[model samples]
Target: MNEETIKNIEDEKFRRLTGVKRSPFEKMLDILREAARLKKAKGGGKNTLILEDRLLRALEYIREYPYLFPYKSKRWGQ
Candidate 1:
């Protein structure tokens, strides 16, 4: 299946488990944070590399949806 199909499946599973709906961007952030925690805890394992790769992908997604995440930029005088 494609990425959207996989995401939909995960979304349904998350909703059923938590009884709360979350946007895909929120889900990506949640997953990325968990991966980061796990990577640190696992330390030096190959799984850490995998988690890092996933984290980068999630970061790219965030970059694509900058409006979903607000940052203080010097250029913006924030």
Candidate 2:
């Protein structure tokens, strides 16, 4: 989910959805932002997804498929 969508969610529900509380999520976002800035300084192309969206997608993947992470899938012949 994006920032606007997340802002409308209740704290408890959001925690349930992402498995993280709002404050910790914001802190994680800040860390991601700093890492992105550092990466940009090293001269890479712009990311297709913004930091917030990327964080959300990561959290979703972790919550949905904890066992599969690092993400080894049959599609990759792993």
RMSD per candidate (Å) reads: 11.0, 4.9
lDDT of 1 by residue, 1-78 (tens): 334443556767745533345565467657777877887797864553443345445555655666754544545666
Off by over 4 Å in 1: 1-22, 44-78
lDDT of 2 by residue, 1-73 (tens): 5689988999999888888999999999999889888888999787888778898888877899877854566
List the candidate 2 regions with Cα displacement exceeding 4 Å.
Answer: 68-78
Per-model TM-score versus the true fold: 0.28, 0.79
Q: Where does candidate 1 clash, by residue pair?
A: none
Local distance difference test, per candidate? Answer: 0.55, 0.85
Residue 17 deviation, candidate 1, in Å? 30
Superpose all Cα atoms of candidate 1 onto the true structure and report the RMSD in Å to 1 decimal. 11.0
